[model samples]
Each structure stands twice: as C-alpha cells, then as structure tokens.
Target: MAEIEVYTERYEREHGHKPVGRRFWSFTIVSPIATAKDHFLHTEQAMTYDKALEKAMEVAIKRRSERIIVEP
Candidate 1:
C-alpha cells in the first residue's frame, strides 16, 4: 500500500485576538496514487499546526485501515 502524505498550511485572518489577528492551521492528506486533478481524501483545521496534523494523520490511518478490511 502507498503511504499517505500530509500537508499543512497556516492562514491568518482579521479578528480580535493578537495584534495581527489569529492564526489558523489547516491540513490536507494526499494519496500517493492521486493525480493533480484528484481531491484530497480528508481536510481538517485546528488552532495549532500540531493539532491539525495529528487529526489529519488519524483520519488518514483510519481510512487506509478501512480500505483493507473485507466486507462480509
């Protein structure tokens, strides 16, 4: 099976928090077999990059494991 790849990006928006605003982190999981035109299997957002990445990895593992199971 191909390994799943995780990508993260940080976005800042205007809000009432810090001087520059708040920073939001988003994560996207890309399948190894996916093409440029293909969409990511999962996407998630969190207050911190680590949290977002953790969630993304969890989802990716779950999805990959499910694909390996046989339905009776």
Candidate 2:
C-alpha cells in the first residue's frame, strides 16, 4: 500500500488573496514513495471541498494509494 499526500485549497490565483469566495480551486498531490510523480492538479469544476476532494481521491486511486494525507 502506498501513502500519499494531497493538498487542496480554494483561492484566486490571479490576485493571490484569501477569501476568494469560491472563485477557484486547486490541489497538489505528493507521494513519499515513487509510486507516482508529485504534481499539482487544478480544476474549476470544484466549487466545494467535497468536489475538490473527489478529484484528489481520483488521483490517489490511479496511484493505488491505500493511505492518504489530506490538507486544506
């Protein structure tokens, strides 16, 4: 089983400010092992944390991760 780290957050990349009010969403995933390359994935489809988490989980699934560390 592989352990992976996923960082998900919502922010407006253009202004680089907080309290972006659900304007943008992005996530970064990292694996401690070489199960998969560490990278970032961004999507505008996610308006809430649940949606963002869903996408992150998909990546984890592809990596066959059994354990995951998620950060908001």
Candidate 3:
C-alpha cells in the first residue's frame, strides 16, 4: 500500500464573509516508482479534517485494490 498524507486548506470566497464555511481536504499518496508520480485526492468540501481524511483513505484503499488486481 502507498503511504498517504492528508492535509487541510482553508477556503476563501470572494463575495462572502471572512473564513468562509467549510474547508478543503486533500491527500497525497507516495509513489512506489522512482519517478514518484504521486496520486492526489481532492474533495469538493469537508466539514472537518477527520471527514476529509476518511474520504481520502477510502479512495486510496479503493485505488490500491484496483491496482492490485491489474498488476496480479
């Protein structure tokens, strides 16, 4: 399995109040190859960091499973 890291970024809207509503959560999967072509998970929106992490992990697992089948 690829190592995954989750990060959160604050979202700022042009026409709204300061801070805005929800934030964006993203994840990056470390590449196994020497080229280091990492995979990224970008979500539409997330209320909390935990939620974002969960979504990212889910996607990573699914992708890993698919890759295993293809490689095997």
Candidate 4:
C-alpha cells in the first residue's frame, strides 16, 4: 500500500480540469532512500499527482541519509 498525496487545486489549475474523476501524471523526484519498494507505496489510490509529488520530496528529504543509486 502506497501513500498518495492529493493537490487537487494545483492540478486543476495546471490542466484546466477539475479532478472530479481520475487523473494521472509521470513524475520523477529525487529520493534519498535506496529504493521506494520498502517505503509506503504512494499510488493513485492514496492521493493525486500533486500530493504525491510533495510527499515524494518529503520522503526524499527525510531519507536523505540513506544511500541511493540512480540509473540511466
């Protein structure tokens, strides 16, 4: 289970569409954690893209001490 954050107003303003239904976006944020697997799975079920973005950043900062490897 993933914790999803929701930023409805922000999303609506950006896309000109209210999140009355389903909305999605592909976003990549820096994560200090080695992997997102063990962490809470933040999915659409949990929150919206905007919220997810914020949470991701927060998680990254909180787990900054953890070693992470980025792949190309």
Candidate 5:
C-alpha cells in the first residue's frame, strides 16, 4: 500500500557486553516522489507522523526488509 526509497547506507549501534553476537541495523527511508505543492517531500506534507510511521512499517513488512544482513 505504501512505498518508500530506502538508503543503501546502513547505520549501526553496538550493544557491547549486554548482548553478544547480536547486530543492529538502521535504515533510512525517503520518499521518491517530489512535488511542488508539498515543497519537494510529499510524504511529510501528505501524512501525519503516525500515518507515515505506519506506512513505513507496512512497506518494510511487505518487502521483508528485516531479512537484510549487512557485513562490515
């Protein structure tokens, strides 16, 4: 239903000592559509914070984005 362009660059936070052999992945998703009315970012002006978050999660689920494993 909702879609976003995810950045290839991944950010990570190391959880030292507390958890071993566990990795964290952070991804940034941006809107692909650019419009003059929305001032370039359609997703921001078109949807509320809750709505945008919901859509982002939906997109992630649909794409099975959690399966991604990046190696340093």
Candidate 6:
C-alpha cells in the first residue's frame, strides 16, 4: 500500500479535532462507477485517535461519511 503524509489541520477538517503532528494519510483508489471518458473519481478520508476512531466507525456506515482512526 502507498502512504501519503498530511497535516493535522487538514485531518481535523475531515475528522474533527486537530491532530498533534504529521499523522495524516492519503490513499488513491480507482472508482468503478466512472466511464471510459470520465475515468476514476478520487475519494479521500481522514483518521483521528482511538476514541474518535471507535465512534467514527460505529456511526460511519449509518452516517454515510468518511472518518478518522487514532491511537488508543
């Protein structure tokens, strides 16, 4: 897997709380829905710490939004 580094501020906007330091990741994924002309659509998500991760995961599916994962 390829790993990308990002800032806490960006992570916070996607997630909620501002991250401490450089703890953001980005993964490029190809979209299957796009056609030949459109190609793939890029999607991004951010992760926070453990407490936030748990809550984010639990409600993510229902909420239909990307969330963050953090250390416990």
TM per candidate comes to: 0.37, 0.46, 0.44, 0.33, 0.31, 0.26
Off by over 4 Å in 6: 1-9, 12-48, 66-72
Worst 10 residues of 2 by lDDT: 5-14
- Which model is ahead, 1 or 3, in terms of lDDT? 3
Task: Note each model's CA RMSD in angstroms.
Answer: 11.2, 5.9, 10.3, 9.4, 10.7, 11.2
lDDT score, candidate 3, position 9: 28
lDDT of 3 by residue, 11-60 (tens): 22333332323567445643353133446556696556557656656656
Model 1 stretches astray by more than 4 angstroms: 1-3, 8-22, 31-46, 65-72
The best candidate in terms of lDDT: 2
Model 4 has an lDDT value of 0.43
**For candidate 5, which ten residues in a row score worst on lDDT?**
33-42
lDDT of 5 by residue, 1-72 (tens): 333333322323332222123233222332233233322112334444345445555545554343222212
Error of 3 at 47 (Å): 2.2
Clashing pairs for model 4 are: 2-41, 2-42, 3-42, 4-47, 5-51
For residues 1-72, write the lDDT of model 1, one tens digit per residue.
656543211222233232122234433434444354432432333244455445556655755522211001
Model 4 residue runs over 4 Å out of place are: 1-36, 39-41, 44-46, 65-72
Residues 1-72, model 4: lDDT tens digits: 243333345545665775433344333333445465544433455455456555555655565523221111
Candidate 4 displacement at residue 2 in angstroms: 26
**lDDT value, residue 48 of candidate 1:** 49
**Local error of candidate 1 at residue 37 (angstroms):** 14
Candidate-wise lDDT, in order: 0.37, 0.51, 0.45, 0.43, 0.34, 0.35
Most accurate candidate by TM-score: 2
Q: Give the Cα error of residue 51 in candidate 2, in Å.
A: 1.1
Between prediction 2 and prediction 4, which has the larger lDDT?
Answer: 2
Candidate order (TM-score): 2, 3, 1, 4, 5, 6
